[model samples]
Target: MNSIPASRRWMYDRMYTGRRGLKESFVHGVEKFITIACQQQSYVNEGKLRCPCAKCQSTKIDGVHTVRLHLFKYGFMSNYYIWTDHGEEMANVDNNLIGASSIGINATECETSNSMHDMVCDALRQHGAFDILENSNVEEPPNEEAQRFYNLLSEANCPLYEGSSESKLSMCVRLLACKSNWNVPDECVDFITKMLLDVTPVNRCLPKNYYDAKRLVSKLGLSARRIDCCVQGCMLFYDNDYGKNDGALLQCKFCHMPRYHDRNTGSSTKKLVPVKTMFYLPIIPRLQRLFASVQTAGHMCWHYQNRSTSGVLRHPSDGEAWKHFDRVHPDFAADPRNVRLGLCSDGFNPYIQSTTPPYSCWPVIVTPYNLPPEMCMTKPFMFLTCLIPGPRNPKAAIDVYLEPLIDDLKKLWIGVQTYDISKKQNFMMKATLMWTINDFPAYGMLSGWGTQGGITDKRRLYGVGKVTSPLTDVDTLINVSSGRATEESEKIIQLEEQVRKSREEARQSREQNKRLQCQFQSLFNVVLPLLPSDTQHILQQQVDQQSHDNHDDQQPPPTGHYGDDY
Candidate 1:
């Protein structure tokens, strides 16, 4: 396959109409989605449907399905979906999935439109969909054990960089500490909190004092009231050793850096609140993480750049956003084609949600790379103007994700720490699934399709690549005309390297996708109805005792194993 030009590639990749019957094509899409879901979620056993739950040894079906709908773009097209047991999950069906298809969003289907506004409106009207997002606002109150863990964390004699809101790191530290020392309930919480938080010794408190304090807070469980924050904030926590001595400034992991508002002084700290770790708090659903990453880039980075009302510095990408920012300085980029932001602030407000420009209000961030400041910050802009399709959020029907479903990563890590040998493996498998579910949104977001980061600016700089084709076939990839570009051995070598890498990724994607289909085909076609009762009993006999089989236990799931590691 020969490489295509950028414009043609964009047009070819996103604009197409399936030649097959619209209904049939739509059906295939939905079926494939369901097949993919199953492939990713579970495995089949000897005539039994076993979820990877450590204690819940029952085989029960979690009712979920994916549906497809059709729409018009001056031409007929189809939409694929994932439905859930909850009716609300399907309430705003069309708008939720296909809305972007109208606005030039080249999904896995590669659908696009010329007029962004028209495409979005068409999708909104046709799909009648709502965002089926899980709100972190709701939670089942934690029990005594879970409460003990929170109290331990609350009394960390020294608080380093901690998000004011409930974030995953806060919870994980508490959960794992509780599990590791669950037996000495009094002292367990303190020991774990100390290790997890890594507070300064000068902050003051004894191990026994740590244990004693928990006794007071133990009465209060880790309920919604206690779980004040979602722990999925933008701040990245780092050890004081790194943050202070190593010139690592304390900053919000998600937002980059946020100065803390002191409780007593009411003054902001030049120092950032640092934490022990900075990797994402796995609690953020994968989709949300993707959106947050991009959104933060726009909100924090772009918003603070040098501002000028004349036009964006140098050549910020968004002409409109650039024009809006030309209030104070010249918009300059190292490349004249590039754009930079100008700065101006309205001082801090107590109710401020983020450091992002005023127009952004949505919780999730859509653009991962630096954004050309949005809109002319003058006059007025619509909420819709700032609204962007961010990477997906983390919350979902646990069924869509693989088993040992973790509502909060803190809880999941606890399960990991205390899991018996046999259970540990099971927990790891579940974690793998969680991580896999999370990885997709990140990858999908990073593919540069979600936002206009890698979008080529034709007029400013036509670094256009090409693939010549018409809207004749939508089922295939961009087709390039083959003339002996193969004559260039160096280019040929590069092409070979590219193909090798692409194929490996595709194979991994294919196999990961195949697992869901295979699991379902094997389940409904073989395991569910075929095995006689006597056979199931005999199979159970092979492992009557739940002990580890002296094998090199760290194997991937027997099935559905395309992981982040690969």
Candidate 2:
């Protein structure tokens, strides 16, 4: 009745190869014993198995004696120990139940043993194998849902001999994500590829190498169109009108900065330049891709129905700006498919600290705020809209680079013919640039609002006549039609102030003229009439003289005195 030490108990726990096998043996033995007992007189009516042991025969005691008792005491306890690695008594039921060389209460020679017990013991040894064979022989009906999943696996066309391309792609993508998330080196991709190809089955077709794998990944990702930009960060190669005119270009139209360095050109006929390329990923296709999946499309619409409006402003949607936007453009806000996007940009040095004179790069990112707040701000949910390649920040000229984006946004506002994946049809897809998120410097660059003013001044400066007209009348509207504030809001405020000041000055000037007229009338009617005709003539002559002096001197009278006329 003593227990084994904790350290040594693991050996007892792992005595069997598989715990499942042990469980099966115990189950089959009990079932076979019941089958044998039922063959005898009224087993179910009596509610006990007729044990043929000498002890049971003499005492008339009958039940599932060996099977239930041994299984409950040994099998269950052994399974616990197998999991927890702690038990007092080791389970030795397998050898005992199999009728091996062990002394027991019902010990007897096989030749003289009860046939039922022998058969029960034999069944335990070959327990689950028979059931497995039976299941394998039975065929299950095919299912439609299962067929779709099977089709996904079949898309890769890898044979059973080799691993499926779907699985390999999944693994590769996971590895790449991990590498990026952990800031691991690019070599990790090569290492992973080599390890997989070497250790995995030979027939499998992976990427030829890491570069090929990268290309495959790019193909699977959002499509990017590269546009050359001025090295001075002056402008993008494609303008708002560049799409209309296909004239050849060599330099920036505005700054006349060369697109490429002179040394980059080859002596041969081909001209080469140090490519300052900006990779722009169109938002419409990305938005369409999100809707292509049923689950994601459903999640994207969650903000409309499930969003909380506590007015504490947990998300941008809860703010007054968003409300104003909705109010201004009720038609655009009517469709949940009309996405609201938040833009973000920040500059960083791609090289490590060890590198001297680091180069700066700015990546523009956009988040679809149409998703719920929890999912909307997550890194994976954010989309890379463009790369603003730079040694220096684009500053106020970020708009020049944003011409393509603004143009596309205008197109979206006008209604781009887009394929609605969920509806399985083509329709107009419109989206709005709800707001931008950035630091102070980036704010000035993106919004064109300088940092020379206080917070209230900035607000008033931005919120007045400078406000962009919410109509797509021009290419420079920059989502003004989406109810976003613009430079015109400031101009409108300034104009109103100018009109008020002009009106107040005119009113004051008229009041001053009325007082002067009243004074002149009093002098002529009361004082001048009392004088004689000659005196009047003399006074008139003096008044005329004073008027002439005033006109010549351009001077007003002293504080309390009129001229000699008084």
Candidate 3:
């Protein structure tokens, strides 16, 4: 860490107006800016600033430029725990904050440059770094995990000083993620490699070629495993007989289609149809990944417990269709924890060229309806369950690609044993395929409902679609309109009559009782003084008994008549 003069820091602060786009200006005045920022803090004085370095702060080295060095090394968001009341050293604090690297990159050299770009650019040219910037139009904001990973690779061998293979591989992954295409040409890969080397801290070591980059990504489990399929698209080389065995048949057993044409054959390799490729990214693992995180796992049960039931049908759960299915299959609906899924399959032309030969690819997607209604159909919540590759649309034959997925769905339906992260327990995780959502064409193909004049389950269909014609029977219509009542209506009328009668009787009883009370009061007031003490006591007893008998005789309202109906 170099000690910067106060005058330089003041000048840098004055020159840099805190504009985001003034990187060039800031870079030229970087030292001054750091000095000014540090001086403004309460601890900085004429020739000294507070030292946050583990070694210097331990000995209270006020003269050390630990604060500036830390900033330059770790970027802006570093040293979160440096400003504590106890004045703890960097080594003493736990560094679990995201993007905080286990190892630090030395940025003291960069302090000489006015801007970060200038420093990085100088290193790029010296190291013969490729220009990967050409392919990247959007620069993603710095991510903590990515930063940590990048720094880890850089620190392995003083990466900025001497580039390492690990650092190059990290750069490769970043390029691939940003690139539109999954597969790129050799020349393109070379260009990306050069660009990464230039920008990466250690600009020397990078992948020799595209193959090397791919090999590294595969080893890291970041690439999907590809399974070869029969040229006729019979089945994926995934099952035990096809994929697992050493002497697995290359030809489709059912269709007798060769997986690959023999090179020795008189036919040109270009004339030979290539083996179909199927990328089967297992859904169970993907789903399990969702449950492994507390944030998403909590949301998985939103539909069952938290979805609105306003009956306006803003979401699928609020509609009659979802409720009908649930009502019909009470056993499946018994557990709110069980996931309900909707299968959506559609075919689209990938090339999007009218002049080219017609070809379409069908992607089978599964969406968990268990997420909150708002997020249920969202891209993040939906999983690409299967891909039916094609030079032609699979149409009805799409079921062939669905076999593996179906088997998995069956296992999930039967309740596979899974660890629930939210509950922190091992439990049977059940999922049900509730419905398939698709366009009219896809619905017919996927659901065996023929598109041409086909009535699906005519009896049920008629029941669902039944519409009454205009009534010719005026008398019946008039009866419906008039007060002519059915058994239910007559019963309701009878109940109403009973309620009225009850009310009338109660009202009459109350009036009679009040009149009797008035008469009794008049008699008691006049007779009380005339009676002897013994006689008065006897008379009071008689009056109390009479009142009790009258109250009992009034009768409680008929218990079962209107009360039960109304």
Candidate 4:
């Protein structure tokens, strides 16, 4: 801390104005502005003399023309840590602070001959970095696809920078949402890439894996939708009871192999469509909302004659959709079938199955499990729906601009086109449902399960554990320590261990019966079929009769495997 000593008071007086304002002369820490302003006044009064302040006349403190803003948004943390969106270097680092990185910020003082606010805001905006709070133009009339993509990107609030913990999570989501992995129409992809690259870059990207994962996914043709549910035996998670577990679609890689969803069901139909099913479990609300958005978009698109890849055209800036795509390929511009996308109120998930190859799930959140208590009481499996990104990393190309994707929900709401319930509604599946509202703070250590009235504590404004929403600027990222899950897992292990002792006694008879059975044949064959046909038939009949008797008895299965899948 720099201070003006008693001996230096004379120097300070000569250096500063010592302005004769008897009302107030408050001196707080680092009052550089007052110092400079006073110097300018003194210089003007003293026969236009040069301002002789120690800062201007001597090398007392570090000599650098740096601009710093007192970000009240950071609360107490700002006392030590400086926050910046620009890619600049930090000369100050203290043990108590998480220092700043220069990405998306102005490190070099811009040479603009304007006020500090104008200079700063202009520099930031020119580089695609603007005070998000100052402008709500994100919803301006974007051309067709531009509007669609923005709606998808707006699935949830995006946080950036290091001021609040949620900022980190938002940054993570934004970096992960790039469109390059989606094979988006080139114009849309190009436009989104330009915006993202202008804001976020790789190594310094919000989620460090943002770049690597996109690259790997692009190479492997993978999407978060690849995993369905882990608890459903890697099968499609049908209407699970509200409290049952759900596995990630991507984790269940083989779930789409035909053998998973359609192995049985007794029907000889060549194909059966999978209806949208909700398993019994609480998930991030944002996922449900995103699904809702997609479903709305699909509805609007279904009605458009020449557009299938459409969303709400909130903004008119969507340069001619087909024309833009045509720039992607000259011939594509003239192709009649290469129609532009159309997004309405009820729309589609960009990634829906076509019964063709490369089937991938619509991008949604990927969870790390066991969030803290403040998020909610149910230690439920928590995950987010990852939104698709629009373009390249900021590091890849700072000035690139891609075309826009639309937001169908807004279009439907504005009555861009009249709605009709009779219009080819897919009764079984609103497959593109984009989003739902669920709270799963990335850093909420105890954010789920086993809290008071978690069953009854589901209210929003009055919820016991609930807090303010992001757009309100009254939120903070929940601080989640990484080792929390390990602690929870140990507790689960102890509980399971105790249950086994009691269950073992109850399971003895079934275990004994199972030990008496043997493999009927080798891996490839069932020897039970080798017997005479009539004999086999009689055995089958007896088996059926015994099965009926067991059902009448209502006995517990002899073992966990007694009624296992054939």
Q: Which candidate gets the maximum TM-score versus the true structure?
A: 2
lDDT of 3 by residue, 308-361 (tens): 655565566665556665666587677666677787889888887789998878
Backbone clashes per model, in order? 63, 12, 11, 125
Query: What lDDT would candidate 3 get against the real structure?
Result: 0.51
Tell me the whole-model lDDT of each prediction, alpha carbons only: 0.28, 0.52, 0.51, 0.28
TM-score of each: 0.19, 0.53, 0.48, 0.19
Best by lDDT: 2
- lDDT, residue 256, candidate 1: 50
Candidate 3, residue 411: Cα displacement in angstroms equals: 2.1
Predict model 1's lDDT versus the native.
0.28
Return whichever of 1 and 3 wins on TM-score. 3
After superposing candidate 3, which stretches have Cα over 4 Å from the reference? 1-173, 181-186, 198-225, 233-237, 240-247, 265-274, 320-337, 454-566
- Candidate 2 C-alpha error for residue 426, in Å: 4.8
lDDT of 1 by residue, 101-132 (tens): 22222322222222332222222221111111
When 2 and 3 are scored with lDDT, the better candidate is 2
